[model samples]
Target: MIEIFGIPLSAFLSQLLLGLVNGSFYAMLSLGLAVIFGMLNIINFAHGALYMMGAFLAWMGLEYLGLNYWAMLLLAPLAVGVLGILIERLMLRWLYKLDHLYGLLLTFGITLVAEGVFRSFYGVSGQRYAVPDLLTGATDLGFMVLPNYRAWVVVASITVCLAVWALIEKTTLGATLRAGTENPRLVQAFGINVPRMVTLTYAGGVALAAFAGVLAAPILQVQPLMGSNLIIVVFAVVVIGGMGSILGSILTGLGLGVIEGLTKVFYPEASNTVVFLIMDIVLLIRPAGLFGKER
Candidate 1:
């Protein structure tokens, strides 16, 4: 058996693949965060809670409504996005002119409320979600055996990330969004509905988080507190990549995942801290983040 640094090649490859899976989730969640921060200038503290809600939505649909994964994929995001729209209109909009901290606090409160409610009913234990029948096996690669579901997650996340990037960077609508964020008053004077755009943008960002949650449901059991731990790591990713940079979020997420995976292989004790260490180094070198333009 071939070995590098006294570790079997297969084990190394397996860890790498697992890391990629984690990175995929980071990319999706961070991308949504970037979008929300770019448009609203608010760091949404409730994002993780909403993500938890999405997974629960999938679980509820399956258990109570007999909905399949494919259907829940569309429905969960739509439901959560609608909820986001309402939150913006009723609660968040009032705080736009206030300090950014107000928005953060409000969302944080919402997260607590949501998590508390879910935990009361579901208890601390996690609920299971079966992998879709279509993606229910593993394939043998030359160096490693790859689980089909994990591979699908990597592929699906990449597709979603690329599509979002293209939407924000290439299309005319994206141009308008960019312009609106830079100067909403001027854009409003030009007859565009800036307020409406802001509402839609928040909803869209929340939808991205929900979509990621749906993707994660089968892999990680549906649980109220699941998003709690993951969100902290994702925030580190956002800080390292810069808060509002779409492309930066994607690349940094994937890259950090692979680095974390490799760390697990070569230095097991450092696997958890490696990303934060990178974040610290990046902050020292470029406070605006690796891709952020200095303001």
Candidate 2:
């Protein structure tokens, strides 16, 4: 019976939860983007396609191999990560020394080709993925009923984000990665095999995307165009957080998700465009992005 601004508390909390779910996806995807761009300087327009591929891979494993959600959760990302490695070695590597536009174009083309291939067989209709048996029910929070799967998603996403942040910021390997990207030639001189490191970095980023896709599969339908539908907003999130900033991406993504959710509650008409509007405002004020270094 309680209300805030004439909106039921339950409705507001529900929207907030939905927003956090979305923000979890945004954080994961943009984290991948940040890693790839920061460590490899690749625009990776195909990231969304890879995400879709992950979801499809999970669905296929379930249908054909009788794999469960837990199994596919591991397998799908590994599969996509291997594919990402192939992509880097076979195609993306060649464009590294070239302009950033080249990498963007190549990845964009890959996105188109991937979408086309999937669409040819699957068509445009979405496929459903059921929630894992263990996470099938809802939990009664004192104020709101929370879906167990959604709670898992938020917890898992935040945990992953923190782990990745620590990996990049606190560890010796992370230091080497940052140095390798900044000066590959110098790192190569030290017998680090910088190229291999770069390849792995890209693979790791791709795996993160796949992981997100797997997480999203049960919530959203598995479809070819799913990636395209969300990629732009993820990109906006990355940009607003500051390109290549891990912490920025995580925080900004969660914050924006909550803001967007609240907008739906207060001003339904602007819900869809609210993120973009914020992006515009951020760009006007800080062109380097909220967390990016001015270079």
Candidate 3:
């Protein structure tokens, strides 16, 4: 067997592919967190719960409404966005008048209730969602067989991340968003509706998370506990990338995913803990994160 770095090349590549998929999810979720935190100064703990809701919504669409994967991709995130708007209007809206800690507590409580409601009904046995017909096969690349669904996930996620990065980093609206977060009162004085913008920003971040959830449904089991399981890991990625840099979040996510994947190939027992270990080391050495500015 041909090997690279004392490991079979096939094994190494396979783990790398798996890591890329995992990184896609991490990047999307952390992007949401970064956007919300940067703009609202709110640590939205409900993000993962909302992500679970998105997957469940896609599943329900297929099971009861005869909706296809494409439809779910378009509608699930919108549904999640609408729900996020409601949360902003009802709960988060009030916290803007108070300390940022209150916003964190409010969202954390929402996470608990959201996860609990789903658990009461789903009971966490895991719900299976089939990949769309178009993505159900495997492709042979001579050296290895790649699952179409996984490939699609990696491509789609990277595309979305780049689009988001371009939007915020290159476009005027992105500039305004960043500026508004820094000084909402000034932006408002300049004729921007900062409050509404703030709401939309949160909704946008939530939509990204929901979109990732829908993408994940067919590959991972749709279960109430899924979001909770992923939340801490994504948080670790956010910490390592810095909560303020969008590009940093995306890069760290994909890079960490590959590193974690390689760890699995070389040392399966340490794969799960590798990300956290990196996080601790990063914190000790660079507390502001890999791409974060020191405060």
Write down the lDDT of every candidate, Cα atoms only. 0.92, 0.95, 0.92
lDDT of 3 by residue, 203-264 (tens): 99999999999999999999998999999999899999997789889999999988988898
lDDT of 1 by residue, 114-167 (tens): 899999999989999999999999999889999999999999999999999999
Q: How does each model score on TM-score?
A: 0.98, 0.99, 0.97
Off by over 4 Å in 3: none
Candidate 2, run of 10 with poorest lDDT? 252-261
- Pairs clashing in candidate 1? none
- Judge candidate 2 at residue 223 and give its lDDT: 97
lDDT for residue 46 in candidate 1, whole number 0-100: 88
Given candidate 3, what's the lDDT at residue 119?
88
Alpha carbon lDDT of residue 173, candidate 2? 96
RMSD of candidate 3 to the truth, in angstroms, is 1.1
- Our tally of clashes for model 3 stands at 0
Off by over 4 Å in 2: none
Candidate 2: give the clashing pairs. Answer: none
Give the range where candidate 1 is weakest over 10 consecutive residues by summed lDDT.
226-235
